[model samples]
Target chain A: MDMYTCDSMPSSRSEGSARSKLLSLAGMSKSYSPTVCALNGLDLSIEPGEFITVVGPSGCGKSTLFNIVAGLEEPDAGSEIRFLNKPVNKASELLGQVSFMPQRDLLLPWRTVIDNAILAIELEGKRRADARRIALDMLPEFGLAGFENQYPNQLSGGMRQRVALMRTFLFGRDLMLLDEPFGALDALTRTMMQRWLLDVWQKHRRTIMFITHDVEEALFLGDRVLVMTARPGRIKLELPVTLDRPREPDIVTSPEFIRLKRELLIAIEEESRKSFAPTPSAGH
Target chain B: MNVARDLLKHLCEALLRGALTVLTMAVVWELVVRVGGVPSYYLPSLVDVLAAVTVAPGAYVDSALRTIAETVLGFAGGAVFGVLIGVAFFQWKALRDYLFPMFVISQTIPVIAFGAVVVLWFGNTLWAKAVIAFYMTFFPVTVNTLQGLNAVDPRQVALLRSFGANAWQLLTRLRLPAALPQIFVALKLGATLSLLGAIAGEWFGDSVGVGVLLLHAMYNEQIPALWAAIFLAGAIGTLLYAVMSYIETRFVFWRDEL
Candidate 1:
């Protein structure tokens, strides 16, 4: 965890640096019906051009944390959420600057692949011709050049997700909130997608907050991996990965990679056991 | 067989099957009429019916036009009104809750029941038939369009929100296209109902149109003319349905999956 933070945190910085701090959430908590506390006093910050992966056990409020940040849900008693230092109330305030991709690909099946990619731009006031041009340009860049005119149903699950990612990027958001974008892919496909995503992210470095349950994926993709505890999830630890530039799958086999992965697993397991353990001194 | 031959064989088989089925139906009808031994004054033969169609074709054509006009006018009115209502309801949740029950309740009031009241109000004009046709057609259009608007994927809505798309943008790009399939469904239902509305209006009040001609034939015991009028009405209805289906195929090619 100490090594993780040091790699991501800049050494010396004056006020007004080129790297803009995009979002900050402090003391954020949320709860709902049937008495479940989803998030508990979560504090986090996203720096521009930084990739942050959040990993935790199931029901750790990872999704809840994302919803609050994306303005999909209200934090119970939290302070204002700052997007570029301005308080966000609804989706409209953060429009055009942050594009969100949910667990599902969410591509409209009736439309062709090209149309699906161009959907975001078309909604942003570009005419059909310009939108198509922009969509076509994103295809080859994302390794989907020839499949532009195909329908979503015609493509495999992985290809459909690629189309979805292209659509999200075409929207031109400075920030992207991706919730398990590759969670639905098969093992072989997921690894391939991770590598492909890394290549894409390098060319166009947008600040990203990816939600996942996989520890290796977190270490592989994110500049910093944030581990959250079980129910009423709070930040348990933060790990910054300083492996190397342009990450490869072979990095997972290294001693440092294994050590970091083991540490994250231990942290998550401890949180899970603590939540499940029967209350002490209950015998009366 | 190769692909082309297979397709050709399927087409020939379908055509042959359809013709055979229609021939059987006609033969069964003729046999039933003969066995019943009803007088010619009450039920005419197929030959008598064919002769009636050719004897006074002008009057039959005029009545056909009037009925067709009523169906077209009512269908257009219902479609326009249904879409407007659908858009308004989708845009405002509060309005949707308030107006949805009212729209459902409107369908419960039968067309025949409404026709009597409409005639009392419009006094046997073309408007009376149009009102009946509109009543029959409007509900399907409204209900189906509402369903379509609601059917847009929630994930897509979230994606739009993230992209900074405003309310208008969501409606035009997502909701409108989603609602199109439902609109076509409404059109199919409305087309058939519109014909019924026109005929019902003529039954209750109109001095012209196919319904009026059928009434004259029935009163005079001219069984051949009555059958001829019925045939023409069926032909007109089939034409209306065909035209609407063709339009649906052309515009909503994407709906082939659904």
Candidate 2:
């Protein structure tokens, strides 16, 4: 375990500087229709190379926020989203700036593991042979060494997620948005994947924004955990984990870990209760 | 060596099963004709038809080849155009809304009724038969292509779009490959329909095809010759379908794994 004072912490971003912020969202809001708001006036600042985990109730606009970040959907007017200090006007302008992994592995069934891993590189108009060579080298690191030629269906669920993670890593974007990537996995596999993911993240040090419903997962993986409110979601609480790393699987059972989990549980439980409460006027 | 043996065993089993079916059908047909005291003109025995084919194998082979050429040409043209139009329709919703109904209406017009008009336009050349075949083949291909394209997982599209995939790249890399299994279904249907169209087109006074031979045998009351022509046509249809199935297996290999 390694510990450092806040002032002496080693970060890609300079300590307490605006320039350290890789992404900042001020009054960031989205609505599918005129009357229905999915996200509302959410403000968040993410430091470079930080692992930020967000947990919220179901239908709490978590996906909407990811969509906006991924350039799949636009935020409503007056919402501000900045990437690397530049303001993004349209949702599409954010394209290729971040690597996004949706909940499902979403691997192309036709493509082999290596081919799927190199899809982002190929899309950027790079040479297939070069991309394939790079993907081949990275396969062993991602635990997919021998299964390069196998289709997505041939691999187990955990292996498929690993392939998806490998694909995101190969994209080599500074910012990565993962939407409940290991939510589908069983308890044992999820725990193993968590430790494996931290090991990879420590080595790569790419800024990651992970969304998960599991409170333990959020606390275990994140340097900072953000709890979001119910529908038309807004950040309700931001708790910084001061625990030392490299964190082991056993650290999840520590007293400090339990304390943090209890605090998050309270915040999340309050928001989840609000989610079930009837709105003033709901429309289909 | 073990894999090879298994493959050989599978092939032998398939062939033996097919042979048994043919033998049983032949015996039943011979029994029905002889026992029922059916006239030769009304219904020929399997042996009579085989003898008729052997008598003038050249004529039967030549006619079969010509019809096959027409069917193949028309099917190729239809498949290419259908896929292109399907892609166009998928890219533009307004275009699909306007043209897809017209395609539906076009299919409703009987092949016989449209074959006469096709002959008038294309004349008695090979093009005339090909035109009818194209007409029959294109509809299923277009319908299935659109269905397949529309059926693509939306999440997959979003994932690619996040990677900054342009329209052409998305189509080539994702949409096209995803649509293959469904597209192959239409192609298999189109194969049989194309053969039927080519034979029907020959009814409009074409001189050299299986359709012409069938018309001649029918009018002259040459029952064995008619059955031989029918058999030749059936064989061609079966062959085309088998070829398409082989292609489907090759291209849509992921379907079996799924």
Candidate 3:
């Protein structure tokens, strides 16, 4: 983990030691009630602009982790989080600092394309006219220029997701947490979205933590992939991609890509068994 | 230009349909009384009813306007109060748990039973009738508003919360807007209810409104006059309901409903 950080961070800020990254969390734990422990002792860190992928089994608390980071869910005490080198005591302190896209598009049905694109900025109490101007400038890149007047229902699933992405992007370009962004898309659309996402990510070099169930997607997109444990979720493995950036589509068939995919699949399969097995585990 | 043209076209179509409906009703009513040899005392002919209205057109018009004004006043007050209460209920679970059941209990005590008491308290004033309408109009709006607010997608709320939206912001921007289709549904129902309330209140001794006219016709054994009062009352309720539906259509244009 120590070596992985140095290797990926080419633009590492050297204001001396302590390795001040974009975000870092240690000893994170969350439990809904006395019986339901969702996450336990999860430690993770993100570099300035590295795209990281997270994969886990069905009940493994990926969403919980994202919620904690997004400031929607407060983790149990004993967790420590630091963002932009400042210690965040409350989960809400991280809000507006990290951009998040949930499993669904969640576009407001009533809002037009341009209006939807600026939802986050509007929420932040910015002047709507200025947000509109900013969103208009960025609309074409998201392939939503002509659909400015159109509502969310009028757009295709892919376009709606892009619009949501634009909303997230327009809010802040520092850190983005995407949970299965293309999970609902068909195979072809998902593949297309991945490529499009890569193109957009390149254009705007924002650090992203993308969660996906697809091993291939995790391999195709990440600078590193983190496989989480089942139930009381924690980082089980963090494998660096070691693949070249601006990666070609044909590289999925490459030996290196296949090798990485196998490694991630093995880690995920082990955890999936524990969650699915009809047996009494130590914790209920 | 196109939107206005479309609105005009919609209005003309609606009017045509309404006219066709009234014509069919009138024809059926006239045929039943005349062709079936129904006595005039039992069921007045449509022509007799129309002639009754023509004879005291000024009185009927004045009475109808008074009832409508009362209904409108009550409806607006009830709708506004209902929404505010709904929001309050949503904000505080404890308050909702305590007061909501009382509201439900209050509803069970028939509005008509205590309607006389309302008249006793406020006495024969428009305010009394409007208060009754307000009572009738509020409960459904409150229930529907609370339901609508609760029905907002939790994920959407989470998304907004992630954007640093405070509770008030969440209510105003996400919950309220998302709850609108449901709220409008209640408003349409409330429109009819308020009218019913206004008329019912007038029954507890008032001399100006259609309710007073209805009582007069019933006692005098003037069957045509009674039919005329019924038609005017029906017209008032239909007018109020039409206004609500129009506002709902214009505002909640995105909702996929007829």
Candidate 4:
């Protein structure tokens, strides 16, 4: 089994490397109420043009982390979040800096495909005609060539996700946070989407932080896979995947892929069991 | 050709059903009045009511047009005000908390009871009838608009916020569009209520309108004229409702599927 320490990896700020630091979280903690702590003392750094997949037990603050990074919520005090080496003082400041996709493909049912794709640009005050023109041009690239005028309900689950992905990409942000984007798809469709996503990622070369509960998905897609603890989640393990890319679906059956998947399963299983364990303490 | 044929079939079915119902009712009424030996002044036969309508078609038509004008005017005014207030309430929690219960209370006061006050305030003008109609029409719209606005999916709101959408941008683009189906529901209810309000207002002393004709027929002891006036009012209300329903189907075409 191959393992790499995060510190040993070349920093984005280091000379002679094409990669550059895009995001860094230091001692990041988030609490929803007085009784609920979602994330605690988490620290991580991301370089540009890397795919990082995160996996954890249910209710382990996976979504909370995404929310904080997306600028929908602020981290607790004594925490620091830096984007492109610049510290952000407020959660709202992170707006428009990163694109985010929730687990459900939240496409507006009222809007047609082309209109939905241009939602972000339209929000930025661009003219509707210009946004439509640009979205029309990118439809074929998103596998949505002839479906521009169709509403969200008219499309299949996979096609809806493709439309959402196109919307996220069209936002043109440097960092993207996608939370289980294909988790709702069937097994066959999920595999197909993963390969298609990789192809798109390779072409775009944007920094991506993907959240998932599936171990095989983590191993298959990420350059680095992070496993988090049961609750008040923080990174418990970070394993760099050594699989060479332009990866095909057949790679999941390979011995090296299986080995990595097994290791990640064990790490995630330990945390999952902790979450399901009965709490011994009485109500305070 | 096929689409046209299908539409024609639907139209025929609807007309056939309506004709059957009317014919049954007419026969039942005619038999009951004749067998009971009821006087024509107390309760007119269906034939007598039809004769009344034919006798003074011009008078009935003029009154119908005036009432339609008041209903349409008041409905339009109420819709505009209701949407504006609903949006304001959504933007300010304090305003909604302080004022929403008041709106509910105002609705409880019967439109007929409020019609007296409307006539006292506006006096014999078309505005008097319109004021009552407006009063009846706005509250449902305000309540439904609020419900629809509140019903927007939180995830969709977050998605827009992530894209740096400000409050106005969120409302115009997402919140307003999402609330449309519910707003249309209230609008349909308002359409019927506005017509009722207009007719009730006319009873407070109007020179023209179906309500005025009904009062004239009642005082003069013209049973067939009274029935004819009632029929015209019912017809207009149904027409308004049908038109509103059609508009709703066109605008909110996604409702059934979504």
Candidate 5:
């Protein structure tokens, strides 16, 4: 772990910035109602090519953060957002700037595998045939070569997620926000997908900020893990993982990995207990 | 080879079942009249109705064709216009708010009441009858089109929007296709209303259509002739409904999942 504080992370505004930051957020807050605040005073910075994982209790505004970044919803007026070192004024300005994947794969039921992958490209007014050609070349690497003509229902759970991932990757954005992309998979499939995702990430080298409830997943996949507090969420801990790349499945059993997992679990459990503290929020 | 044989078997079974159902209905109709000893003035025999149609087959055929033509013209016009208006309503809330109550009021005014005005406007041509049919058909289509468009999953809309889809792109690629099943529901109802509208429109001084023949039979107490016209009209309606259903199944292949 670097000796850097996540609060005033001297990465984005540093004078000796050898390389520029990919994304930075300060005072990022969202409130659905006057009484209900979802996110409060979020500050973070992401460097290019970093795989950042976030863990928080349920209703911790993880998805709200993602929506703001994906340009689906606006943050409060005073919040600061900078992408590629340029200040982002409104969420609309960030539209189509980041590739976003929600919890579900959300493949169009009507579109075929190939058509679904090229949807973003086709939406940009590119010819369907040309967009199709681009998707065809990248199919094999995503392990979906023979399944071009097949529909979403024809594919298995893992295959469906791959198709969604393929769609996100093909959008050609510098940053990707993945909200529990593999949360629906079975355990064995989830393990296989996590490793395959790292392989894909390494090859593409795009900045990724992923959200998950699983502490092990956070430790195994993320370069740095951000643990968040309960309702009215704010970062409680930012634990940097020093694990080397090309990490095998066996590395998950290493002592260092276990130590990091224990620390994260403690931080997350504390917040989880606070949320369960006897209050009207629980029954609702 | 096995798949082809299975398909053949399924088609044969469907045909056999449909034939059995018709046979049962025919038997019940014939028995109800003969055993109950109903007067010919009240209920004509099944064979009498068929024989009546066969007796003046040429006239019956011409009337049937004319009525069908009017219905088709009206149905086509109503279908195209309803969807266009439905899309307009969906895209512009202000237009929907302004004109939707007018549409409801228009629907409330009975088509039979509208038929007289339609005849006055268009004269005794097929255009008069078709106008009534168009009137009867468009409201349901408009209501349903708006409903179907609104029923689109917002998540799916969001997914497309995040991909940089503009409004037109959203409608054509995602909204329209997704709303097809609901739109087809409106279309099926419109088919029936158009046929009803056509027959009703024929009541206003048309001398050569099925509605005119029915009026002639009723006034002159030609019970078999009335029954014959009624049966022919029923057959036409059934045929149109089946066509609509077949088209719906063909287009809405993903409806099962939705």
Candidate 6:
């Protein structure tokens, strides 16, 4: 465990310590009633501006981990989490600091693209005009510049997700927690979205905790990939990717990329096989 | 669907419906008066009713306006109160647990059975009619609004939580907006019941409004007048329903695609 003075931490993170001590989960466990243990004693940390992807088999508490960090679920036992150096006692305290993009793009069906983008800022008490201006500036980056007047249903799945991402980005938060954001996209669209996301992330440079089951996705986008075991999830391993930035989609065929993908596949396959075993372990 | 074609087809169908309904009602009235051998004093021809409506237009119109005023007031007040109650229940589980069943039980008592009680408590004024209408309209609004609030997506809640939205923000931004469709359902139901409530109150006690006029006409065996009053009541109800539908379309238009 590392403890740094709040003043020494990056000032960009308004919570406690800066220096990318960004988000850490230590000895954290969550149980939904008695029968289900969603996460068990999971320990992990993300640095500032780091793109960390959590890859796990389905039902491995990847989304659960996001929920715990977002304050949607209370952990059964753990040391309190600090954003900067300040204790994160409740879900609301982390609101403006982290923008969460859910698996399903939950754009308000009634609101236009621009309005949906402005929602978080409006919730934060920014003037409608200002929030809208900020949201407008984000449209071209997401390739949704002309669709401002359009409704969510009018957009394709990939476009909708881009709008969703734009909404999160326009909220102007430093940390973004994405829960299988591109999981619903088709393969080609998913690739396009991954490229777009990397471009957006490069420019915004906010710390991100992305949850996905795709090992390749984790390797492609994350600075470090955290592989979680099946149910009663725990951080099985964290592999750092020293791959250079501005990488193209074709980089997935690179030697280093192939090696990392095979390693992630083996680790995930081991977990998948364990998930089906007769007496899988409950707590790590 | 082609937008203009759909609209034109819908309008033509509606007009056809109007003609068919008028023809059916005329046949039923004529049959009751002729075949059932009911005297002209009790049940008159549709023509007679139209004549009565034309002769005493001011009287019927005045009563209708009064009844409509009561219905509108009651619906608005009930909707406001119901929304507040829904929001309160959404926030406090303990309160919801204790109050929700009570609210349900209140609905179980037929409004007619409570009519006299309402008059006794509130007296025979327009305020009393409005109170009765409000009671009739409020429960649907509360129940539907609560369901709307409860139906908020867990993921959306989580997303807002990540943004560090406070309880108020979560409720206003996520829960309330999610509740709009449900709230609209309640509003539509409330609009219909508001008319019932106003008339029910007047039936128990009150010398003004359509309900009272209907009673007087029934007493004098003025069948045409009675039928005219009935027509006005139906028209008013339809008008209120149409207005509600328009408002619903205006606000929750997103649901039209679904």
Chain A TM-score of each model, in the order shown?
Answer: 0.87, 0.92, 0.92, 0.91, 0.92, 0.89
Residue A83 in model 2: shift from native, Å? 0.6
Considering only chain B, report the TM-score of model 1.
0.84
Candidate 4 TM-score on chain B: 0.89
- Model 3 lDDT tens row, B141-192: 9999999999999999999988988899899888998889999989989999
Docking class of 5: medium
Q: lDDT tens string, model 1, A66-135?
A: 7666666676643446788677755345556677788988887668899999887887788999899878
Predictions ranked by DockQ, top down?
A: 4, 2, 5, 3, 6, 1
* lDDT by residue (tens digit), candidate 1, B1-258: 574565456556655876798689778767767888877776677778989879988889899999999889999999899888888887788998998898788788777777788899988888889888988888888878888988887767877776767888888877887778789878988998999999989989777899998999989878999999988888788677766766675567676554
The regions of model 4 sitting more than 4 angstroms off are A1-19, A280-284, B1-20, B31-43
- With a 3 Å backbone cut-off (N, CA, C), the pairs that clash in candidate 5 are none
Q: Identify the CAPRI category of the predicted complex in candidate 4.
A: medium
List iRMS for all predictions.
Answer: 2.2, 1.1, 1.7, 1.0, 1.0, 2.0
* DockQ, structure candidate 1: 0.50
TM-score of candidate 6 against the unseen true structure:
0.86
Error of 2 at A253 (Å): 1.4
Model 2 TM-score (B-chain only): 0.92
Per-residue lDDT, model 5, residue A57, is: 94
- Candidate 2 lDDT tens digits, B158-209: 9999999999998999998899888999999999999999999999978899
lDDT per residue, candidate 6, B1-258, as tens digits?
575565556556655888798889789978988889887776787789889988978888789989999999999999999999988988899999999999999889888888887788888888888988899888989988899998877767767667667888888777887788899999999998989899888998777788988898889878888988898898888778767766676678787543
TM-score of each: 0.85, 0.92, 0.92, 0.92, 0.92, 0.86
What TM-score does chain B get in every candidate?
0.84, 0.92, 0.94, 0.89, 0.92, 0.85
DockQ of each: 0.50, 0.73, 0.65, 0.73, 0.67, 0.54
Candidate 5 lDDT over residue span A1-284, tens digit each:
11112232222233455678899887887777666677777777899999999999998889989988888899876788999999999987887789988888888888999999998888877899999999999999899999999989889999999999999999989999999999999999999999999999999998999999999999899999999878777788999998998999999899999999999999999889978776634222
Candidate 4 local Cα displacement, residue B10, angstroms: 10
DockQ: which candidate is best? Answer: 4
lDDT (C-alpha, whole model) for all candidates: 0.80, 0.88, 0.88, 0.87, 0.87, 0.81
How far out, in Å, is residue B160 in model 4? 0.8
